[model samples]
Target: MKIIILGAGQVGGTLAENLVGEKNEITVVDCDTSCLRELQDRFDLQVVEGYGSHPDVLEKAGAEDADMLIAVTSSDEINMTACQVAYSLFHTPTKIARIRSPNYLKYKEKLFQSQDVPVDYLIAPEQLVTNYIRRLVECPGALQVMEFADGKASLVAVKAYYGGSLVGHALSTLREHMPHIDTRVAAIFRRGRPIRPQGTTIIEADDEVFFIADTKHIRTVMSELQRLEKTYQKIIIVGGGNVGLGLAQALEKSHPSVKLIERNPQRAEYVASELAKATVFCGDASDQELLSEENVEQTDLFIAVTDDDEANIMSAMLAKRMGAAKVMVLIQRGAYVDLVQGGDIDIAISPQQATISSLLTHVRRGDIVNVYSLRRGAAEAIEAIAHGDSSTSKVVGRMISEIKLPPGTTIGAVVRGEEVLIAHDDTRIEQDDHVILFLVDKKYITDVERLFEPSPFFFF
Candidate 1:
């Protein structure tokens, strides 16, 4: 970890192309000499050209043996003055920054401890793409959520349509139709990686599962997979910029029934005077007759946060071929999120891979409290927490096939107390458990934090 990124754009060249092959030591900076000669002909880093908030260019981009200094400069005061001069003259031990001013994330922790601007972390890909479209408009059929720690383990993402009834169900018969539900069906991105379902992993109608629960049983696995869609009362949003004006001012201050559309008629009258009860629609969202003359097939949810990724994947596949039903696409090109999740895009949100997975989980804070980079980053679900002089006390109650993990890491769930195990090998991991591992090498994330060593809150 000797990072040092500073804006080469597109979230610092997608966080130096996903920290290249992770043994760290990156270095990027850039006053665009052809984006530092196209990131030095594509990665083997150390690019540095100039002006990453000057000071002799953060001391020639080394920033005093930088262990992490990010600052994604699309100028929020030059990424908070290049992470406050690399944390006040190169004391850079994880400085982060990115802040796109929604009034600097509304007083972000008293401006990071009263402007001691050594921004330990601040990122705001328009508030992480409007908190990832307000967790898919507050779970209106949950096609992806992921929250961990603060909410305590969760990973939602559903989508099995046709006659729903848990389509051809399996994975242990949908756990005997929720016998006191303690969810798990961990991975199943079908035509992608993360599978391990077996018991005839059926459930395929529109198939895009990923459950792993216990954020209070995630509404009992979205009410036993009928794909719960109660709330979201009409919400269209095709792109007015800044993640569609911060998701139409966060669904018009959480009142929903919003609309937006904006194909720049002065940014649709500045998002209709900053979302005056949404419904802006100034024109051309790749006009399928103006998205069926603005009914987008009776929208229930069709967020396609514009800044053109082929007009947010062709207006979210024309609001999922005009039926809407739920279609989210914000693709800030993380390699086109697998070509708009191989079409039919029902949840693509990338905002530069969610601000480089919140700046590599805040430069890998102590024993990783969170870290997502799923599918395309091949794997890394993380969340960790176990400490208690962690070595995970030699497999706390051992079973995960008798604990010798580390192959491409797995232990998908295990929150303990509020129960959410999903992990097999007779599920155990006790002491303050928060587990959630998925890993596929980030250098074995400190050997999966020494098999979950003693961690009782010590976030860097």
Candidate 2:
């Protein structure tokens, strides 16, 4: 696949790194010569330094016959225009643009069309990150939560607590603990090492457990692995930028006691006006006095989303020290994410990862509709639809046990229409069933995609 990425920034670079070794031809375009040089030195891909949205840059980056044009440049106008140019001039098959501004998204369905902006997909990282954190807050105790099958089913990651019913028990006993609730333990990680879940596998304390079930049954399933935390009410957010403001807007209705701290007075005023329930204040978030005045001790969740990594870390740490029940820091540096988790910060999330996951879903082949990166791309949770029939597909019309899944991969759940069925040995997949699978090793993703691909004789 020949792909042109219109940015050399973090998200674009990371996306290139991910796709370079995946048997795809990657070309990156950017104005920063240093960034292009850095990417070229690290990966086997072509890089062109110039204005990303420019027609000349697009052509130089191979837009004429490119399979996909991913415009993730920082500027929303540039990204959108690049998509327009790709479609209007080069006729790129798939044009994905990272549009951060919500103003344009308000008219997305009407504006982004073959006769308009021509973006096949819109990757809004801020909105994606906001949704990610919202899910974590709603599903307490989950390290991560990703919705699939149009929110009918979800994949949740939670750490095993000592007192939970299934903490020390074998995986087979999950049914006994919650007889009516159907769920599947997808994969487990112990001390950063992947563990393929089995009937006899015992869930140890501190083990990271990934499971999939109906969205409504998620909390019930989580309760068996760890005691459910109380619903969060009071929340504190630092940063008045896109992600922070977006998160405040999304959570303010449910969590009425939301407060946001912003260093810029103008942005704070904008946030204050945009949100009805959330209180917005202008102050230095890392200031101990400012946090104290905002009642940090009573805060249920403290989130630092400032653009500066060190500042976010400092503010979140200060809030955690001041008695915030949980602290989640939005760190931009990939290296800092692994460093901050399990310490002062309760959770660490990267907007790049969310953007990458969204892009990868569209980039992937076959019937894959959703793809989530877990444990920093070592693992993946995929939601793919089964197509064709017994003789036309590898997975359709086959039992869960009969499918030749890659090693360390597990069938987590199957979503059929509105019903969520937890995967089991005897569960047979039918055409159009949304199959949710977890792979501890992402190298097996191609195999999974191939398994779901329809034969040459069949078409969706």
Candidate 3:
């Protein structure tokens, strides 16, 4: 596939790097000669130095014959204009633009269709990051949550806390506790990569565990682990940036006691005006004296979503040390994942990483219905739709053992009609049922898709 990407910033550069290994002919265009030079040296691809929004520049980059064109410059206006220009001049099959403004996202569809911008997709990093964080809050016990096929199956990250029933037990011994539950410990991300667990693999305290299971049995699995599910009441957010403000507004509507701390008095006043319920405090979140004065220890959940990684980490660490029940930090740096795994922070959300993952999933949706990079792309939790014309349709009503599944992939759940089926060997798939599978390799996307026919509701 021939792909053209505008803006060689963090997200654009990350996308180029991920797609380089996939054998796609990629061309990146940017006004900054330094970024273009870096990209050319780093990846096996072509780079064009020019303003991406200009039609002549896009033409020079071969946008006319490109399979897909993506504009992700820092300015939303530039990105939108670039997408429009590319679509008008080149008629690219797929056009995607990154618009960071929250207000623009609200009317994205109307702007794209009515205005005839010819953009097929809109990516909002802030909204995507906030949605990811909201899922964590919704499922408090889960260390991470990856929804497949619009909520049919989920890969949930769970931690075995102190005194939990499954804390000291081996992975194989859990069958006695959950004899009827249909789920699997697909992979264990101990330090970073997926570890092959044996029957004797004991669940350690504070171990970040990933489980592939049906959406219905998620609560059952958490209950068996003896993790308490509590509704987040009092919430404290440290930052008035787009991430923090967006999250605060969302939580405020849910009636949670929300407080926002911003170092900038002007930004704090703006957030306060936007969120009347949330008390906006003008002070440094890393200041222990200020946090103590604000009674941060009493907050049920502490969220550090500042623009600075150091500030976010320090604030989250302070909140945890001060006895906050839950602490979540937003770190944009991907390399810091290792630092967070050391256990000072409960959860670290990276907006740029999430954006890259989301975009990569979309680009690879030729066969896969849904894709979530678990354990930082070590394993994937994918949802595939079964087609009636596929070879696997003959085993629609047969047991899973009878069907020939690809290697390194396991059926986690099957959604037929409105029913969420916890997958078992005896569970049979229907013609149009959505099948959720976990795969260790992403190259199996086509093989999994061939198992079923494409569904109309598969993609947005």
Q: Which stretches of candidate 1 lie above 4 Å from their native place?
A: 1-75, 78-84, 87-90, 99-124, 127-140, 147-154, 157-210, 213-224, 227-236, 245-260, 268-292, 297-300, 304-360, 363-422, 427-460
- Model 3 error, position 276 (Å): 4.4
Which model scores highest in lDDT?
2
Q: Candidate 3 regions off by >4 Å?
A: 168-172, 196-207, 214-216, 390-399, 402-407, 443-460
If both were scored by TM-score, which would come out higher, candidate 1 or candidate 3?
3
Q: What lDDT tens digits, residue by residue, belong to model 1 across residues 121-195?
A: 677777776886787687777766778867667787686677666677777777777787767766666655456
Candidate 3: the clashing residue pairs are 143-157, 386-452, 386-453, 387-452, 387-453
Instruction: Write down the worst ten-residue block by lDDT for model 2.
Output: 451-460
Question: Candidates sorted by lDDT, descending order?
Answer: 2, 3, 1
TM-score (C-alpha, index-matched) for candidate 1: 0.37
What lDDT tens digits, residue by residue, belong to model 2 across residues 68-157?
Answer: 999999999999999888888898999999988788988989988888788889988888898998999898889999999889999999
Q: What are the runs in model 2 whose C-alpha is more than 4 Å off? A: 457-460
Candidate 3 lDDT by residue in tens digits, 88-117 = 777878888898987788877678862576
